[model samples]
Target: MKIDDLRKISVIGSGAMGSQIAMVCALSGYQVTLQDIQFESLEKAKALLNSQMNKRIVKGKLTEQVVEEAFARLSFTTDLKEAVSDTDFVIEAIVEKLDIKRQLFAQLDQLAPPHTILATNSSTIVSSEIAPATNRPEKVCNMHFFNPALVMDLVEVVQGPHTSDETAEITMALSKRLNKTPILLQKEISGFVANRILGKIMNEAIYLLENEIATAEEIDLACTKALNHPIGPFALIDLTGLDVHYNVRMERYAKSGDEADKPSSLIVEKVERGELGRKTGQGFYAYN
Candidate 1:
């Protein structure tokens, strides 16, 4: 389908990424449905988006009327079928698990219209792994959006061999409509482009923390001052969620059988303690 054909969009999952992505689409004038199985999660997402919009208006980035119009175009639902059945595009931003993603796509393939494009916001799992579960493999591609989707400027659009030229082109066009920079990778890789490079820094940072070479604060300061990165590896993981980090590593190790792909001891411990970053109010660094 062409970019103009994509009028109604459905986003599965109601977490930070999913909510912000829905916001992006809604603000861009697309009718957006943000879906989650739990009613509480949907409520939380609505509240979070409202608060964020208000903040933007207060900062003069958007007018009150514009925020209201965007919210008018946005809706939340607990019913999966209702969310995607008539939508032109579906973006899955659920937990980073292969089996779960595959299951979701299989259901979405059955529910959504045949012409709907299915995309994933996963930064780790490639679309190829989940596309096999769906009949429309060509419509499935990785549309990885960085953390704080509303703020991050770069989106990685990875097209696997099964992805069609039209699918990739339309996704790139949609990204532009959302007012963000989009890079297309004709070939698909596990971590895509940015994450693969970022993963290396995260790995070494985890090692340093495990070895007690430096405190998280000290390391973060070094990264911000010397490397010119806005946030350090630990802080970045915290923003992305420690459970996500642990899961991505575990998933990689399961596939590659590489010891290096296994989650670090620090990550495992943090996840076990339920210190899953910003949402949980604590992670590598405490929030509030």
Candidate 2:
């Protein structure tokens, strides 16, 4: 199917990423459904989206009429079948766990329209690992959007071996429609492009903190002031949530069986303490 054929979008999981994605699609004039298994999760997503959209209006980035129309175009549900029954595209932004993703894809494959394309928002778990769970492997590809999807500009579109050319092109086109910069990876790779580069930096930052070579603030300051990076590794981790990195590391370790691939001791402790970053009110630095 062509990009024009995609009239409806269903985002599975009502967390921050999923909610922002649904809002982006709706704001771009597509009908969108944001789905989660729990009612409370859906409510939180609603509040989160409303707050962000209102911020856009306050900043004059978007008009009130436009935000209202975007809100009007969105629907929320707990029923997976109801969410995907007529959707032309499905973007999965649930947990990073491979088994959970495969299970959800299996269900989405059975529920979504036969012509719908399935895209994953995972930067670490490539679509190749999840495509086998569905009959339409050709329609499965990676459309990894960075955290805080509404504000972040970059999206990585990964085309797996089983993915069709049309699927990749359409996903790229759709991402552009959402006003995000889409970088196409002709071949699938774990962590795609951006995250792979960022992971190395994050690991080194964790090592430095663990060795007491520098504190999180000092390391972050060095990255910003010396390297000229817009944000420090530790600050970026906090913005994106430490749990996400922890899961990526865990997944890598699970597959490689190498202790070196395991999450850093610092990250493990932070996640254990529920200091997941901006969403949790604390991470490397505290947020009010």
Candidate 3:
């Protein structure tokens, strides 16, 4: 399938990644349906997208007319069937659970049109494992986007055992059309590329904190000054949220069977205390 062949998109789940993905597609001129099981979640996601667009307009990065057109191109609903009914493609951006993803794919298999390609925005789970459960495993592939999917340029076009070449090509082309950089993973891997590298740095950072090597502030400052990194691993983890980091780390660790992949006790302790970084207003440091 060619990129132009895809006109309508069905985006399942309306969290940060899903909502951003939908906004990007709509802005790129595709008719987008943002669907979630919870109506309230859908509402929140819609409002958040609007807020983001407003901020961009205020910053002079986006025009109000473009924002209006983007919103007009989007349709929101809680019903899965209604969203996928006429979509040319489906992108599943649900939670990182194997069973939950498979179930969603199975339903999409029955609901979406036969030619509709079903792509997952999963960061860790193997696309191959999730594809077979669906009716069109050949059409199933991974289109993993980073956090703030719309703003991020890189998109991992992951291919599994059953993934067809055409499916991969279409996704790659779509990424370009959406003004994103797309990298091809010839084979399936646990962490793909970006996350695998990120996971290692974070693990070492946790190890440092666990061994009491330095204060979190000191560690963050050193990375920023020495490496010119925008944010230190600990600070990034805090910004990304400890619970999300822990979950992705656990999945990758399980795949690699690496002991170092296990998240440090300090990380878990912070998450347990609800110190979820910028979101919770505190983590390794407090936010005013």
Candidate 4:
């Protein structure tokens, strides 16, 4: 199906990324259903969307009327069948676990319209691993959005082995419609492009910390001051959540059986302590 043919969009999961993605589509004049199992999570997503839109309006980035219109175009639901029954595209932004994703996709494959295209917002896991669980593998692909999807412009459009050219083309066009920069990946890799590079940087930073070569502050300072990165590895982890970083690393290590791919002891310790980044008010740095 073509980009214009896609009217109803369903975004699964109402976490930081999922809510923003649904808002982005709504802002672009698409009917969006933001789905999660918990009503409380959906309510929080609505509140977050309002706060984000208000911030944009205050900064003269979006008009109040536009925000209202976007809100009117959005809906929240807990029923999975109701969410995807009529949607032309489905974007899954749930947890990064493979089995969970596969199970969700399999259900979506059965619920969504025959023309629906299934996309995952996973930063590390590729679509091929999840597509095999569904019958419509050709219509399944990865549409990886960076954290804070509303702010991040770059989106990685990944093509799995079974992904159709039409699916890739339509997704690329849809990304542009949402005012995002889309980069196409011809082949599937675990972390794709951006995260692989980012993972390497974060791994080395953790290594430096583990070896006691420098404090987190010093390493972050070097990255920002010398390397000119906008945020240091430690700070970014705090923003992205140490648990998320650790989980992705563990997944990679499991797949590769490489000790170098394993998560840092520091990350493991933080996760074990439930000191997950900004959400928990603590990580490498304290938000509290």
- Choose the strongest candidate by TM-score: 1
What is model 3's C-alpha RMSD?
A: 1.6
Candidate 4, residue 194: how far the Cα is off, in Å: 0.9
Please, what are the lDDT tens digits per residue for candidate 4 over residues 73-123? 999999999999999999999987888999999899889989999999997
lDDT, residue 98, candidate 4: 85
RMSD of model 2 against the true structure: 1.1
Stretches off by above 4 angstroms in model 2 are none
Candidate number that wins on TM-score, 1 or 2: 1
Where model 1 places Cα greater than 4 Å from the true spot, the runs are none
Off by over 4 Å in 4: none
CA error at residue 240 for candidate 2, angstroms: 1.7
| Lowest summed lDDT window (length 10), candidate 3 | 246-255
TM-scores of the candidates in the order shown: 0.98, 0.97, 0.94, 0.98
Model 1 agreement with the true structure over 12-52: per-residue lDDT tens digits: 99999999999999999999999999999989999988899
lDDT per residue for candidate 3 within 63-118, as digits (tens), equals 99999999999999998999997888898988777789999999999888889999
Residue 93 displacement in candidate 4 (angstroms)? 0.4
What local lDDT does model 2 show for residue 276? 98
Q: List the residue pairs that clash in candidate 4.
A: none
The TM-score, computed over Cα atoms with residue i paired to residue i, of candidate 2 is: 0.97
Reference-based lDDT, residue 65, model 1: 96
